[model samples]
Target chain A: MSTVKITEEQLQLVEKLGLVFEGPGLQPAAARVAALLVVSDTLELTFDDIREILNLSKSATSNAINLLLNVHRIEYITKPGDRKRYFRSNLARWKNVMKEKFMDLEKTNSVLKEVVDQRTPATKEFNQSLEEMVSLMRFMNQQIPRLFKEWEKSKS
Target chain B: MSTVKITEEQLQLVEKLGLVFEGPGLQPAAARVAALLVVSDTLELTFDDIREILNLSKSATSNAINLLLNVHRIEYITKPGDRKRYFRSNLARWKNVMKEKFMDLEKTNSVLKEVVDQRTPATKEFNQSLEEMVSLMRFMNQQIPRLFKEWEKSKS
Candidate 1:
């Protein structure tokens, strides 16, 4: 078993981020996964090493790791001669994630606009309000690609 | 009373966004506020107009409006003959709100990093992982100003 000890202070910090350590849901496990990723960014621990240190069952650990990966919050790297896959968080991929999230929000906003359009309002004012939100979100969505492009340029 | 008939589809859309039509938490209030902003943007509804439609007590609606204002999720405007404040969601302003949320996330990530740094046996791999998250968040934060500038330029 790995002898790495998690401190109370560390746990507190993790908890502040809405991560539960010993909670009744996937939240705690998720938080631990995030904490592990944060630590792993500065350490050289493999999956086995991390699982042992956290004292989590293999299945629980794997579930957490899988969730992070699906969100693009964590990534796996394979080292030659080491069959074990090493997991790490990519610090530069959030831009894409944010972009994706914004796009999804825009899509939802569009659907809402259609609903608003179909609803006849006794209040002309209320109808107008819904239309404006649709316009605003659409405008923002239209601007995203340009925003990302400029972001890419500055990074280069 | 503004007879704005919210369609079932529209209600579903709002619910999906976590806007509460019926709930015990601030969530419903928050959702009402958000919906109000959406309406105000297009309909130019005055504060009194919003209160009547949502069926919320004036003070309750006022408080919810204030919360949205503080978050930059909505803005209030005053017009001639309109002693009452008019509220609307500023689409352009949402970029700032999103930026602030990203900064908050970065702060949380940093705190997590500090905790990992103080943990015993300080596995190099774990530390590396934390650093990676911090770096990723940092990069994302850094990209914001440039992205906004580009967005502004493109809009012109």
Candidate 2:
């Protein structure tokens, strides 16, 4: 296992970025989890290492890990000989993360579509605007996967 | 102004979608500000109205509004006779919002580049991964602007 000591400056920035873990709300526990993920690439820290360093309860750490996993921001792997799960940032393969985000955006557009569909005729103009927003979101979602595939091909 | 009452269920769903104002993470104040922008289209609301509805302090609300304005998510338009700054969401046009977000993503990729460049050779593999991440982000940034242009043309 690598012993990459995180500097104070890097730790501060990681915590600030953690504020973006879920969306706009900054939860300290979430931030701590995010910071660990950010440093994980270099540190190669196991779950035990992270728990000890952050002083987080096992369940709390598990929950944070789960959230990051849900977002495709981090991944867990087991070493060949070790049973302990090791977590690392998935930044190297961010295509999956972008794809997930675009899917969420598409879902939001669907919600807007429902709003537009349910509105009265008096607000037809507003409903048209919402429809346009949905179209824009959908268009982006369709294009992203293709773009990423092409990018990956080009890199290879 | 159309009085479209958002149901509690709808609000709860939006909150889960990271649309309604929660507080800062990946779903930044931008998503909430964007939500308010959409909601504003159906119901004319002042800055105070927005602040109250989102349960945000004046400064936080102002900062979010400023970001929305910068991103062209919301527009500042004055009434014919009123000097008060009236803000409205631009649901009909989202090309500008896509453009702004792409720009922000590019800026973040640049920062990531600096971090990767400054890292030690011992962590060279990790640094390479970071560079790949930066490349992917830059590609997305480049693709989005072109996609928006095509979208705008299609709409016209």
Candidate 3:
């Protein structure tokens, strides 16, 4: 329902960003839909509006939107007195996404821990390196949340 | 030549981890070689040794090792009186890799800034949200290096 017109170049940028998202595990269509929604003028668009603008089939749009919703990438908002649901990029959830990415360091740390536990090599330098990697991940794990808190404080 | 023999289970884990690395950007062969090098007992394996153990073809192993080296994922160490070069996980370079990943947030912020500038929307909430995303990225950009330094201090 947003009346603001999006330019062709902007649409191309969205298309390119769609691929970037795809690198992070999003399906092609879902990435495109998310990109389109993020760049939308109102940052919220109806299903029909998105489908038309993206030139996607109804099923594709529905599937893409649903995938995004499931992943908390996009969320739906219902307007009072309007039966249609409008979807927008869940910008708030981006912090969560970033937090999840930072958590990957923890995953790598755990994997390394398991490897070291199993190996138990006598090489002091190798063990030191492994422990250092684990410690760095732990430190990052501790710090990432604090960074989020700092951002929250600054926002206020 | 590392004297410690790698077990079958360890090799299987390396195979699994290769797929994980491939998800990020590395090709399959390169990811496998990287994982194999990471899990090596001495953390340093020569090209021929890696190819023989991983059962990779000469060109395949060479290409994979070269790719990993180019990306700073692995590094070579030359032993005195040995013509063969030993390759190992570049733990020191991982900080660089992490810094690069953190810098991606800046790229996203810049893209979002450009989009907002071009849009110039009247919606206060949308603009505010975009600015907030940019600010969070800026905050992270500043904090990531400090976190790295903290790790270095902890190491010393």
Candidate 4:
């Protein structure tokens, strides 16, 4: 009923990559589903295909798919005349992920600045270092846009 | 017996920061401990001070402290003639944390390259985009060292 064949090696890669996503707070099932989509041979996979391939429970598969879809980590399309939805990894938004990380750094810098402002002069050295840390973060946050531009320029 | 004091604002900041650290897989009590040391008035905190301030159980405080110490996220100092240990946030190692994150990006890129290599031609479009993602990652990985170097030069 299906043409998808996953090698043991591919299965191992899926778990390894899944752990990488899980490092950033993604749930285990959703992470595994995302990795499976990325490394699978088929361009797109239906819900049952994903569930069966990963040996996940029906609810687990549905929940994982929903979460991934909500986050835009994975996307789906419905084929002409087919009622089932096909899900696939959406690697195109990789730039947005990096930008969001940079934004988080900026937010952290502001928070630390407020912390620094609230500190006593007795913590002068630590405050100075923390300020420096914020400066460095600001510098890195600025670099992401430039880096993306460079990547884009090289592509064209 | 204690000179340290925490404001309502600082306490809120600690919880906010605990959530930030938790995003990267740090434990709750440990994250709170690390944030507490950063925003607290005192440079270093005793075990009892930490446990009381954060309202953590003895075992929770001990486990969190041990984990932060083991990871070098926090460090301890012992004053002469004092039997108690004084723990503080090791913000100086923040540079190393950023470096480790970049290293992680490099690791993920390599694993993704392997994914692209093993993928069938039917998924060519996704494969090429994945390759571009890897290339962009490699570029960013190279940028981190240069960013730090630029930062150091500016400092001196």
Q: Pick the candidate with the highest TM-score.
A: 4
- Point out the higher-scoring one by TM-score: 2 or 4: 4
Supply candidate 1's per-residue lDDT for B114: 68
TM-scores, one per candidate = 0.56, 0.66, 0.87, 0.95
Question: A44-114, model 1: which lDDT tens digit per residue?
Answer: 45666667766678888888888777877678888899797877755457556556655765655755665
Error of 2 at A2 (Å): 11
DockQ of each: 0.12, 0.30, 0.46, 0.75
Q: Ten consecutive residues with minimal summed lDDT in candidate 1 chain B? A: B17-26
lDDT of 4 by residue, B10-105 (tens): 899899878777766688999999899998888789999998899989999999999999989999999999999999888889889877866888
> Poorest 10 consecutive residues of model 3 chain A by lDDT?
A114-123
lDDT of 1 by residue, B29-141 (tens): 66666755553324456666667766679788888878777766677788888586767766556555546544665665566556656655646654554455456556656
Ranking by TM-score: 4, 3, 2, 1
Clashes of each: 31, 14, 0, 0
Clashes of 4: 0
**Candidates ranked, most accurate by lDDT first:** 4, 3, 2, 1
Give the winner by DockQ: 2 or 3.
3
Off by over 4 Å in 1: A1-4, A16-156, B2-26, B40-42, B57-59, B78-83, B112-122
Shift in Å, residue A134, candidate 4: 0.6
Q: Could you tell me how far off, in angstroms, the CA of residue B16 lies in candidate 1 after the best superposition?
A: 5.4
